[model samples]
Target chain A: MMKYYYDLMSQPSRACYIFLKKNKIPFTPCPLRITKGEHRSEEYTKINPFQLVPAIEHNGFNLTESVAILRYLCREFPHVGEEWYPSDSKIQARIDEYMEWQHLNTRMQLAMYFQTKFIIPKMTGTEPDMKTVERSQDRMETILDQFEEIWLDNRPYVAGDKITVADIVAICELEQPSMAGYDVTEGRPKLAEYMKRVKKHLQPEYDEAFEQVYRVRGRFWGGENAPHSKL
Target chain B: MMKYYYDLMSQPSRACYIFLKKNKIPFTPCPLRITKGEHRSEEYTKINPFQLVPAIEHNGFNLTESVAILRYLCREFPHVGEEWYPSDSKIQARIDEYMEWQHLNTRMQLAMYFQTKFIIPKMTGTEPDMKTVERSQDRMETILDQFEEIWLDNRPYVAGDKITVADIVAICELEQPSMAGYDVTEGRPKLAEYMKRVKKHLQPEYDEAFEQVYRVRGRFWGGENAPHSKL
Candidate 1:
């Protein structure tokens, strides 16, 4: 059996979690509480030297990196959906292009914004520097513009009309800022609609995976009364 | 014929260039001088709306992003070597892990350092902020440590015993800071040896592809007498 390690708070972990649930792949769930430093334990180091979550242990093979884990699972499991990761070389390359581009763009920008505004402050029990938060927000806006203009222009999904793993990973990143009470889809109808479509397509898995994020926000910003009460 | 568009100055572009050459994939070279703003031109946007290089146009299928281009080329062309991207599922996943990990870690850190210390200063004809350069260098050092400890520990290559596309991409990124006269291999015998092995194995192709980078470094730092005179 495959052992999947993750934390719901992590954007990529949720992506992997949704992928697993949607694919119906059987795995042993090893949820690590990142805030409690479960990932930093010496034992986890043997599994992933990097000490990051969203790792997998299949049989005896160990693999880290969420995107790699997703790819590996698709290849290893016969039942995994092709619509998410098509075997067609060109379509797969298109998906690969978005995945590669997002690492330093969508993933980095939204993550920085979320951490600067929410996670870091909550963890340290201190106020975040306003200047740094503004800078992160500014950088994130540029990335969002690019995401809208370049990736999502006149397209229903990031890679193409059909939903792929790119959409899953992208939505996961885009939602991180929302946990900080930031409205990322504000003023961007294309993105707003895209998110709705993605959520609708992924259905129960999307809502189920993001429930923890919503709960976290509710706790941080006062239950059910926060600006982004629902994602 | 496949149309390859790139600017050798960009790290990923050089990675793709080396892969194509080493794999003996035939393509028409459409070199874009990024410094001259060729990549940003309206004409090039049609080829890659993101306006970045290391793109490809094969059978009217246009694609961007260097990593994706390399993967596509490997799959599209049978003459491409298997050792660089093995057919073994586990080995490919291992390579995938590094490629995914490098984006925010190795690629971002080194590129930031290089840009802060060398490229931006040269482009603006202004002295770089020492504090920013130092911060970038500090971040890069941490990534270098991870690269040595996690990836290269007790192994000759990044993925395993044989050289892979990950090694090519890794060396390209690790060499960027050197252009600014920083010895990244200092105090790290493992990384130094790993780089040497990668360069030796890829040889001629590695040196050939990096010639432009060496020229850029030499021009910026002054002839062969300048520090890091040759990569």
Candidate 2:
């Protein structure tokens, strides 16, 4: 049996988790308490030298990096539908385009948001630099604008009408800033509606997995839910 | 016939160019002169709204980003061998692992090197800041150390004994700092040897494509050859 090593709070981990559940790929969920620095332990290091969450081990093979893992899952479970990753040359290329672009754009922008809202404050015991945070927010907005004007552009989802791995990868990262209370959908009505549609398309099992993870963090729909957890 | 829009000096463009030549994928080369701002022009904007180079148009379908183009070529020209992108799930996963990790580690670090050596001097209208340049160099060293300690180890290439798309993508970016006279491989003999092996594995036609571009810049092998043409 394959094993999934993840921390539910992690954006990438959630994407992988949702993907696995959506496909019904059975695997042992080995949850890592990232807040406790378990990811840095020698045990985890033996699995992934990079010490990042969202890794997997299967049949004596270990792999790290969310995109890589997702690609592997798609290959292993082709029945997830060609829409998850189109076999057509042109559509697949579009999927690759989003995957490549998002690393520097969506992924980096979300990391910036996380560092400002979470990591920096945790490390220094001080509020994040507002100037830097605002800059990151602005950059993220620009990317979203591009996404709407180019990639989405009235389409049902990224890549095409049917959902694909590109949407799964992107929506998870886009939701990160929202979790930090940034509310990226503020000025972007099209993106807000798009998000609603995506959530609707996601399998119930996958949606439940996301809800289960978020409920533990005491957040609903990625924002303040009145009473915050003391833990 | 497909048309390729690229600027040879750009890292992603170089990767696409190498892949095309290596696999004998014929296409019309439409050079976008980045230094002259050709890529930002309205003509190029219509082709790729992001205005980035390495965009391609084949059979009326337009595509941007090198990774997308590489994968497209892999599908269109499957004769390039499964080794470039193995059919085996585990091997392909390993290739994907390096591709994702290198984005931040290798690509970002090299960008820092380019910024310190090229962009800073132009912006300040004086000699570059040695402190900033040294900092970038240190970061590159750290990244290279990880490349050796984790990714490379005793393997002949990044993905394994066979040179895959991962190695091609990585080496093109790694070669950028070398073009600026920073021989990153100087201290790491193993990396230097591996680079030599990769260069040898690249088809002569593809090697010539790079040779033609780098020779004009007079920075083919770093050091004395790396004289700034504009200077």
Candidate 3:
């Protein structure tokens, strides 16, 4: 049996978790709470030197990085719908383009917004810096515009008409800041439609993965070390 | 012929340029000079919404992001040998791991070092702030340590004994700072040896792609813009 290590609070980990479950890949879910610093424990570090989430241990082959794990799973379990990772060379390239671009565009940009607006200040019980929050929000808005105009652009999905890992990964990052009470897809019809399509397509797994993250938004609203929101 | 849009000064651009050339993939080199602000042109903007280098247009399919382009080229031209991408699923996953991890770890970190230590100061005609430079350099060094100790761990190549696209992308980013007369490989025997191995494997194409980036080191040594030193 494969051992999957993750914390849903992590945007990338959600992608991996959703991917594995959606594909019906049997694996043990080993939740490592990032807020508890469990990810940095010596044991976890032995699994992933970077001490980040979305790592898997299968038959002694350990791997980290959500995109890598996703791609590996696609190959390791081809019985799953090919739309998630497509078999055609051209379509795979398109999916690869999105996966690669989102690292900086969708993922990192939103993480900046979430960390500045919520994570750092809440975790430490300090007042969130308005200036930092405003700056990140501004950056997020610009990137979201790019996401809407360039990426969505009336396309049914990020890759094409079907929901793929690219859409799953994109939705995970886009929704990460919702843990801070911010929705980047707000007011963007194309993105919102895309989100709706993704949400409906992913169904209960989508809600289940994001439920804890959204619950976290309430836990730290007024700061002052709140009980760890059961993720 | 495929169309390649690039600027040698752009780190990611170098990766795509080298991969395409090394594999003998036919592409019309369309160099976009970042120093001259050519990449921000409206025409180029239509091609890449992010307006970044290392984009490709092939059979009406346009793609940005060097990793995507490299993977696409590998798939579109499988005759280039499986070692660059690998026919084995596990090996491909390892390469994907490196490519994904490198975005935040290797690429962004090195770009920060080069930008703060060189580009920002030179472009603005302002004195390079030692504090900022030191901070970025510190970050760069830490990630390099990660790359060496955790990543390499004395492996002959990034993904294993054979060379892969991961090596190509990593080498481009590692060499990016040499334009500032700085070598991250310096004082690190393992990284230095890894660079030697990559360079030897890549051969003349490696030197050819990095030519202009290496030449830029000579143009602004004393904080003044010198004539473009021929690469």
Off by over 4 Å in 3: A219-231, B219-231
Clashing pairs in model 2, backbone N/Cα/C closer than 3 A: none
Q: Fnat for model 3?
A: 0.93
Better of 2 and 3 by DockQ: 3
Better of 1 and 2 by DockQ: 1
Per-residue alpha-carbon lDDT of model 2 for B1-231, expressed as tens digits? 899999887888888888888877889999988878999999889889899988999998899988778878888888974858877777788888988888788988987898797666776888888998899888988998888778888799898888999888888887777555676676777877777778778867556657644673463344454632212
Ranking, lDDT, top scorer first: 1, 3, 2
Fnat per candidate, as a fraction, reads 0.93, 0.91, 0.93
Task: Indicate the docking level reached by candidate 1.
Answer: high
lDDT, candidate 1, at B28: 98
Q: lDDT (0-100) at residue B24 of candidate 2?
A: 77
Reference-based TM-score of each model: 0.95, 0.91, 0.93
Q: Candidate 1: how large is its RMSD?
A: 2.0
Model 1 residue runs over 4 Å out of place are A221-231, B219-231
lDDT by residue for model 1 (B149-218), tens: 9899888999999888999989999888777877778788888888888888888998888888777667
Docking quality class, candidate 2: medium
Interface RMSD of each: 0.7, 1.2, 0.8
Query: For candidate 3, what is the lDDT?
Result: 0.83
Count of steric clashes across candidates, in order? 0, 0, 0
Q: What TM-score, to 2 decimals, does candidate 1 have? A: 0.95
